[model samples]
Target: MEPLGAGDPIRLGPYRILGVLGAGGMGKVYFGRDNTGRTAAVKVLLPELAHDPHLAQRFLREAHTAQAVTSGGVARVLDARIDGDDSRPWIATEFLSGPTLDDAVRAYGPFGADGVRALAASLAATLSDIHAAGLVHRDLKPPNIVLTATGPRVIDFGIARPEHGMTLTTTGQVPVTPGYGAPEQVLGQRVGPAADVFSLGAVLAYAATGRRTFDGTHVAAVQYEVVHGEPRLDDVPAELRHLISPCLAKDPAHRPTPEQIAGAFAPPQGADRIWRTGPLAKDIARRGAEAARQATLVGREPGSGPSRRRLLRASLAAGAVVAAGGGAGAWWLLREEPRTPVESGLASGAKLLPRSTAQSGKAPKPLWGPLPVAAKPVDGLVPAPLSLRDVVVFAAKDGGLAAHFTRDGKEKWRLPDVTPAAGLHPLTEQLFAAAGTSGALRVHDASTAKLQWELPDADVGRFLTMDDENLYAVTRGGQLLAVDLTMQSIRWTKPLPTYAVRGAGPRAAVAGVTLVLFGDDGAVRAFSTIRGLDMWTIEGQGKSGSAIAPAVVKRKDSNGTSYTVFLGGRTLKALKFPGGNEVWKAGPPQNGTDSWGAPLVHGDTVIATNGTTLAAYDLDGRQLPLNGRAARGPLPATPLVRQGEALWAVEADGRGVSAYSTTDGARLWTWSAESRGPWGMSGAGNRVFLVNDGKLTAMPTVG
Candidate 1:
């Protein structure tokens, strides 16, 4: 929670506001408590918007609608002041002390089948109660459901209305969330309790698989999919799919009622224990304790033994509320920073590259320089550069890992003992993982290069990938080792498949609970992050001599959001995540040879090379057209990198780099160097960093 800012009220009604829990464009939700020691989430309308009749009525209606539902599955309204002109309009509800469903799923990974069933039953019962109150909850998405000590408790009645009312909206705004909303609601037609049932199905799908049932690239496309497309349940477990499918029926009349859904799901006896035990329960208990402490310190004076401000600072320092997730509009007990891929311990995906203003067909000038900071190639291989938030890291020519400012080629800091070959991975935006001498795992601050933590017994050989909880690496003996970050101890170790350890070390990526490793000898393997058990494997994807490094991209298509691994070999293949099942495959161009290199994914397109030609394909593996002049190149076996509209790779001659327009694969510009060495490329913050021989250069991206 943030400290109260200027112009903020100290109290509302009988409650004393302690800190700001969360805020939206319309108002703010304050962490509040009364003299009786009861805590509440007090939502008050913005003073400026209080005079706006439309917003004021909506705010008041939320209070009335929320108060009407008297179920233990919902947050009870403690007090409300909506009728008086002299008072500021506010509604205070019991503060829920737990993460929202969205936050929980994103932080802890998707729930197991039994856990999802428990969630389904709890939410269904809540929806049944809301419908019984002669009202319809128009917004029943993940963020509205909080996983408390008891079970899931539905919160937020901001858009609820009478069951007979038509969907309401101002101007062109849609009344419901895009992917989770029912078709009738998307059409702005009359919605019944069935709308909430449809939303429940979407929520359950996400809870089961950590993916939405319907998704698209933009808001309009998602709404259109909700209206006209079928719900994607391929990723949802087979046994549970049958129960969730019926609730997402396109027609309202075909969807099951909340009571029927509750009966159908019928969680096992003691299923509620899923939320009452394990790490999730521990997190909920921690938050609850923090909330109680905040309540006790609320009315303390400035010079008291321990001030509320100091307690809040202590809470933040203790990582009490680390990250918030879900829709931006959802408010919770305590707001925190949002989790990024680095923070969540997930594989980083393509960021939205900044739009360049340079002419589309013109060659852009260098943004920084061709600085001589890159290390010379070791056995014909240059370490791939890594891009952090503000600095680009490389293996310095003087022998060590060095960080250079992205804005300019100035050196920020260097670690002479760090081994770039051991594989450098970002643990968070501010911290990174690398190996010190003798294969010891070390964590360093990104900006200061200070050693924050180290594990001397890790016996690290090659750093692979990491997630929120553990850092995965391959030991010198070719065994996969998982080190738990929270416990600072080894979690598990498993022997690598014989094929995976025969040649160069494998490249790895983490998606959800699965960690995928692609070996140099064309061996692909998937392991469960929870236990280091083998999940699946595929052999002979490429020739024995070739190196393979597959790229994973999260794409939303007719099959919903798929964490697909794009593997390039004789064929460019898209494999479903976790299972390594081939979704689609495309062979090389009609007359081209069968050899292919590693692939790169940007947005919806996957780009790769076949030694003689560069090709682009959609996530579905359908080959896309490229301009004739730029499509053909004697590209080497290297991974492609993208920045803005340009896709950069080694040019035909292998001594320079060429940038192609991502849209049509037309040649945009080219940069050549005199050095006769391999090229490495990486991009971040709208600038592309290139390493040729031992020279590093940063080039500006053009439209």
Candidate 2:
């Protein structure tokens, strides 16, 4: 291997290697040039990881997803392929030039408020792009943030989770990480995008202050603190307090989502200050802002203050009902609403719960088990927040789309026995989603509370995306269809690629002029919407084995032609839009696989996650700096990016789901999200919708 800093040619997929752009626990990334003389970077997995199929699958997924995504914020993939025999698996991508956030911060302390705000905006926009395409970069941190000449580019997608593909992870294995992990991620609970938001909160906290939120004396202590303790914002400035507070909420449901994060961050800049008061300070401030209230903030000397202290503790415990979780960025959400709700049972039952207390921000010296949470089912939900604009569609335990919303875990709109909850299509701007499971193409319109139309007897696996005009559809039996709007007659029908055995699920994107198709084997067919002509067939070069489903990502480039792509271990392929040219390719090094995610393009960065570790590349395809990372698993769902500064994805192991950030490769947050059980969850809006073994639950992202 050559020095990453030195642009030396090395051996990689159909390309000579160059200097190393960056290095991480997974492997070293080198800046190289492809056979077509196009500049690129090849990611080489570490020798120790080279043989691990889990990491190998993750590697390929990064390539597949990054190549498909075309966004201004993301780096572009040039070429990809796997090396033979003993060679490494490598991914070649366009090179990105910029200074890492780590370098920028070191060169110039903390970024100014305006700079941070700009960075946040860019990252938020980037997140939106990938999220739309359903890709999540599971690791986001400051180091991964790059300040390019054009602007800040978020790069690195090595360990990001993807919507499809499988990773090689051993049974009974535990991942090693730091203080930034969320509670559920640590607990290995069902995870989703919010976990990354939690990581962003940690990264932001570190960026604002020179220290970590839960930097304990030991890794164990730090992990414990991350799951239970309140962070010390003693050094955070006033302007950032509220913005940062929501990210630290204790309950995953309470944390604001990336959208909320961006919205809150987009506004006014507050002065910077260290918070000396405890986590309970906000409660005390609201209850005792006036010195005469004298409950806690105005404690007197010694004996006199003892009673005041007692009152403060009592108040804190009583109000504990409202502690927010990071599923929205856990603990930080605590401040948005008081711990005590207007009519919380916990508030009423505040009589007593054995009185052991600890300092708010300081890590409590461990005695045995987890410190008790102030309340159960944290007050995470926004007070009377509006229901989701899109109605939830789910298959009844037997099979059918069921819609439900909960303000207090109450069902909103539920329609069961609708087959293929995965095949929902929102026809006519109306709410009820349409899809076919076993019977005819069923259209459930929540707006009318009835079935709009049913193309009787035609068993379909899914309904492609739709506008007011036509409904693109695919059946498990290998039939592609275009149904009319206005409940009119069928417009046309065509046979799809035979490889599309599974058929693109209902979530397929079909718009204005394009129809994106997914194949069971890592391939995608982009068709002209109106003509039904196969515009282009895009495929990632993957290893011999059962192939994963495919997806298309939207590339962002003011100048470059839009490209669509997909993922596999160590390989990424990008297809030019309109014409379907093989624009660029990136392959893995020495026995690696492809990237994960459909490959997301945002800003000047192209991201890949969940292959082995979260990784990012500049729009030029160079590897970017990063901090947080994740292991491989089932194809991950696209993440929700907020503030355009970070990307988040859910990490699932046999235990549960956890979220990760792809920007600086940091672990943002986590919650009690579980994998598919008797009753599972679905990915529709930027929230984690769960029906755990028949118990319906919802967790929103904490911005």
Candidate 3:
């Protein structure tokens, strides 16, 4: 860690650079704090190299690669500026407070068998997640692995590329660390997920015995040993030799897969405590606390002076162990900042939402107000609120749609001519698609309410759903249309079945290449997004009066990636997407005639209300207990929403909301409001927005 020298940027994007953590060949990593006081390791490209297109592309690629893997075993990317421009590109990653594997091993001795097994299993799981996202981490070594309170997190994806990508390097440069890189990577050959497995073997061997699997005095000798020479495993334990030796196999094809490594090294129960309970944990905690205290001092004394600079430098130095060991894996202290009102037109990019610290066991007061923002429609159906960045868009009280800042109940903008019945759907973070009174398809900038584009003859009566390429809508004449967003033209239109268009527009959801629709007649249909071709249809999917909302999710199983649609009605069912085949089905509560309402999918759990009881099930149709008594009042047909650790749903009375723990399904608290009939609920930015009888209220979520 060092003081900011001449020519260093004071700020990049939303982050304020406090001090420089370290410098590498391509750029420098800085300790940065955002306006919200969230900390990050902001990596900036060297100004001299910013104009190098190749370096710039690789910098941006690192950001994308790190963001692709969604696992707790990796440092989360907070924000990045990858757009090619005159400004220097930078990436902000959550600062992890921990010592690097190398530092820990140097301070303490080599890990015991239990510790080694735990490390192997955790790293293997992270590798599996990386491979699942179609990437191969080319560098897996001690310095890049951080030991945190939770577990070992793999960091530094600087050279990670697609599984099928060939080894890329500049002239005279090796792409991987000498002792840890696979033989294929050493020979500059094409690599795949197996390459990461080879690196994992080396990492585990080093962890078990403070020695590398392949080592030599010179870099060339180490490379030679990796490609053709036998590994030196004399120091490795006898029981672990067989497992570690196979990983160092000369041929990539002969190496064990990550799953095999994890299963073979299955650590005993309570193995994770190895990191949480040892001296290593104390070291990590001390560094984190000192860094946190210094951050507070710097925040309290924002004035620029020698004393402030010295304090900032000390803070960065205290956290240098994290920066040195984990490279870009360091993160700021995890603490909540004060919630402030949002400025108009500002996008909530990578910003943590303001959360309420209220206990879930008691009712929480409204964060904002039960303002009259929605209109009491003649049909008694209130449109569900939609969140775009910082604003929550809803059906305006007077007419059309209105966008309100989530921080406060202040109205940001409104579109009086936009038809709420036609639907308001976000096209992107900055733009949204809506239907006009004349059935015209229109797109507007979300922040300014400025119209970006429109098609007068699109004849979109109701917006069903949208994807990256097109918007799916329906016409008053019962025709389904796919509007090509890029071309601003109609891609395809097909007449819906006569029974599919009765009452309000068909409830819809998009699953990969398929568009699923639940007709008023309780029938479900799937259509191809490329062309309006019928894929499959299921009859009698819902009960007579049940809301036919279809929840779609993509799940990976033994057969690979497959989309499954969940529906409520005559029975709760999971149907294979596009094919419309029954995957699993569960009957309503035994000995009762109450049918299932719309289902909600969160991770592996699918939740829905059956009569007065709330039930949860795995995707395979196994029931799980909610731990609390079922709702005594009538549960509505709306889908359940998850925020923080609780699942929220419209209460049985149709005028209140209930919170239940997603872990055990125990009812937390109930919020009641006076309302006539239909109620709509949506959650975003750590706040739950509810609309009942034309009144909109914002409530805080448990932190």
For residues 1-703, could you state the per-residue lDDT of candidate 2 as single tens digits? 1122332234576655433444555666654444455544466766677789877776777778876667777666666566845555677664444334543343223544645555565666676666666665555665555444455455666545553322223453223245665666666555556666777777677666545667665666777887888887777778877788787787778887777777777734432111113212232233223222221222233354234222322222111111110010111111111111111100000011111221121222211111121112111110011122334444443344344432233234545555543345443223334544454666545523476456765555555566434666675566777766433446666786565544222234543367766555555566776667777655644332223333455455677546454443346555455565655656552223344544555656666553545556665456777545454444343332332233444443423333444445555444343433222334323344444333344444322
RMSD values, in order shown:
18.8, 28.5, 21.1
User: Across residues 1-703, which tens digit of lDDT does each residue of candidate 1 receive?
Assistant: 5566787778787777776666766778776778788777788887887888777776777878889999898888888775334355788887777877876775555777888889988899999999999989887887878888888988878778899687856565665776888999888888899999999999999888766778876778788898999999998899899999999999899999998988888889877776799657877887787667656655674456546233433222122322221121245322222111112122112223244533345455676678887888776667777776557788898987998876557788888998776767776545678888778888887766888778888888787777656788888778899987755678899997666755455777777678888776776778899898888777777766565677888656696666888887777788886466788987753345555777887668788875555687888877788642333356666777877677787765666777777776766666776667777787765567888788888887753
- Which pairs of residues have clashing backbones in candidate 3? 94-331, 95-330, 95-331, 96-330, 96-331, 543-569, 634-652
TM-score of 1: 0.51
Which pairs clash in model 1?
Answer: 345-467, 345-468
For model 3, the stretches where C-alpha displacement exceeds 4 angstroms are 1-361, 589-594, 627-632
Best by lDDT: 3
In terms of TM-score, how similar is model 2 to the real structure?
0.41
Name the best candidate (by TM-score). 3
- State the weakest 10-residue window (summed lDDT) of model 2: 344-353
TM agreement with the true structure for every prediction: 0.51, 0.41, 0.53
Which 10 consecutive positions of candidate 1 have the poorest summed lDDT?
339-348
lDDT of each: 0.73, 0.47, 0.74
What is the lDDT, from 0 to 100, of the residue 405 in candidate 3?
75
